[model samples]
Target: MHGSSSRIVGGDLASVMTREGDKVSLICQTDGKPDPTLTWTKENRNLSNPKQGRKHTHLLTLVREEDAGEYRCRAENPHGSANKTFRLVVQSTPNHMGTMVPLLVGLFLLKVFFCFLLILATFWFSNRQKKAPVMREDTTRG
Candidate 1:
């Protein structure tokens, strides 16, 4: 008797963010004693098969707000069936990371600048300590 099992590969089963007019594909790979058949569904409705293979990728094109919802991928074999769920989130604005790139770069540059300053200071202090002190006459002599 074969048992049906499925697994999500290359991606976590969490909310995926995408913008409008973007292409999105949800990936699912299954392993079973008997090769499991993969099917894609959204909101309990069957979705048109996209890329077909042991690893199924449900292709979503030109995504809109209405296209965002719970997606399920089921792998069924002779024995039993297993499924996994993923969420799609459509954002009106650009990716949050896009706005943060400049900030991150500035912070990185600041860190590099501080590091350079620290190295220069260490070198300067070490070189100063190596130099001998100048001899001075005893001014307190009677």
Candidate 2:
């Protein structure tokens, strides 16, 4: 009698997204008459010992930008072998507050500059009005 052929039962082969310095896990569940041997690789390079025993969970801790790439998980037994592929995308966290602070300060300074210009213009108009000479009527009728 022949044992059941090894087959991939459950796992996620979809592209995954994560941030730098974060942790992630990829699971690869398999079913067979005899327990299948699991293996993992990144960018076609072997990961050595990436699997967590029979749980088939590959843990990535303190993930970095360099870690973003194609990952593959394979399971093999005497009968046959099966595999799955995954894509990891790493993004850097943006500092919104830091960027907004400078923008806000620039806007405030622009407002102050416009207000100063308005005050100068009002003062100049008032001085010009005061400096105007009053018309005087002729002393004797022609």
Candidate 3:
């Protein structure tokens, strides 16, 4: 679905679609008497046009997790300027690290078991020393 007369004199327009965890492709279409200046913008920030001299369609690919947001395409000609907005949703796949939580917990428990064994050994040695017999010589009856 396209919106109403977002058209201008120079004929610069941009459209794009994006999905999460996938690449985003921006297509810019220009049709003017001479040629129009084509540019891209996201959240009002200006974007450099990769296709400088070409009057045909241009495609820009962005592959990044952080590149998920609203993107605006501005086509400017001598007559006027038109803009179209696109919402990009970048979905992140389930990470393998998330699946390792249980494994990590098991390893931690193993470590705790080893520590407990060390503590038990120390306590056993201390108790054994305390139980040893102590001898004193009898000086008067010898």
Candidate 4:
């Protein structure tokens, strides 16, 4: 979805997800003068930037089922603010394997949860490393 400073003007943000919980993507396009900061929010909470850039396009990857919700994109500049909304629906395959299938699904879900947590942790640690030196240099200068 797109938004503008004076008037929220743009197209719908496009997204795709697999029913088997394999992959996900979110794309937003916006057009405005002086450009606008594009951001995504779910349930009123601002999401972390998936990438660093000053462009009007934002992309998010590998979305999970829990990420499904009313997604709003807000574009804001010194002039004004604008926004757009989208509903994300994550589908899952039906379980036809009976009782044992439920247990297997539970375990699989747990595995995916831990894997996501691990990825998040790794990203956090990597970001810390990249910023620590800059922070130290600034402190030393002061």
Candidate 5:
């Protein structure tokens, strides 16, 4: 009969944080007495991987906010199943925001300046179009 046992290879608790749009890999390993079959899952759903072994690495490229979750690696045999959980956190990259703020401010100022010039131009044109008081010259005995 086949039996199994599980032990985390690297650390007791596994966790990683990476910026969005970046690639990350989470490595999970288990030492099994009988060398149980291993599978990886996230949010209780099995994850499809082309490679399977004692040490499995989940590769995520161009990570997004939705990719953040808890991943579970299960090692199972006829005797029983053992599992370990790891956390993956995806964070927004601050570099984009840091550069965006200044660009937005510059655009806003340009808009304001253009609008002020438009109003000034409109006022000048309206006053110019108005006819000045007609000048009258009267030559007569007073």
Candidate 6:
């Protein structure tokens, strides 16, 4: 029986966009009479050891700006071979201070309000104590 040529299960050549520190997966499914060997490359450089077969999916965790580039997946068997290309684009993370500024301001204002209440409570207690002694003296004289 003649073995069928290897082919990608899905159509190839895709562009992937993600922010820095995001996780992404590049898939390369293969179909053939015999299971095909798979390999992956980034910018023409091998991702793993040449002898190792990386089949199906290549996962990237905590993606960085440097990880953005052209990637390729190749499936090969005795009968034939197939290739798929992917272009990864990484975007910068949004400014955190845009949200943090408001949060910080809110916390500062809350602290100031609590301090003002504490000061008023201290003044009231001191005045009450001073009047307590005066009232006791008047009652004693009467």
TM-score of each: 0.55, 0.62, 0.54, 0.50, 0.64, 0.63
Model 1 residue 124 CA deviation in Å: 76
What local lDDT does model 1 show for residue 35? 72
User: Candidate 2's C-alpha lDDT?
Assistant: 0.83
Residue 119 of candidate 3: its Cα lDDT?
Answer: 100
Question: Which has the better lDDT: candidate 1, or candidate 3?
Answer: 1
The best candidate by TM-score is 5
**Clash count per candidate:** 0, 0, 6, 2, 0, 0
Can you list the residue pairs that collide in candidate 6?
none
- For candidate 6, write residues 1-142 as lDDT tens digits: 7788878876879899999999999988788767788888998898864322335788999999999999998888888988899999999898899999999999999999999999999999999998884434456565
| Alpha carbon lDDT of each predicted model | 0.79, 0.83, 0.60, 0.64, 0.77, 0.85
RMSD of each: 14.3, 6.2, 8.2, 30.0, 5.4, 6.3
Ordered by TM-score, highest first, the candidates read: 5, 6, 2, 1, 3, 4
Query: How would you encode candidate 5's per-residue C-alpha lDDT over 82-115 as one tens digit per residue?
Result: 6677888888877787899999999999999999
| Error in Å for residue 38 of model 2 | 0.7
For model 1, state the Cα shift of residue 14 in Å.
2.9
Task: Please name the candidate that would achieve the greatest lDDT relative to the true structure.
Answer: 6
Q: Which stretches of candidate 6 lie over 4 Å from their true place?
A: 50-55, 97-142
| Cα TM-score of candidate 2 | 0.62
Off by over 4 Å in 5: 1-4, 49-52, 95-142
Q: Estimate, for each residue in 54-118, the C-alpha lDDT of model 1 and write its tens digit.
A: 78777889998898999988877666667788899987756789989999999999999999999
Model 4, 66-129: lDDT tens per residue?
7677777776666676667777777766657777888999999999999999999999999999
Q: Is candidate 1 or candidate 2 better by lDDT?
A: 2
Candidate 2 stretches with Cα past 4 Å from truth are: 50-54, 95-142
- In candidate 3, stretches whose alpha carbon ends up further than 4 angstroms from where it belongs are 1-21, 49-62, 107-142
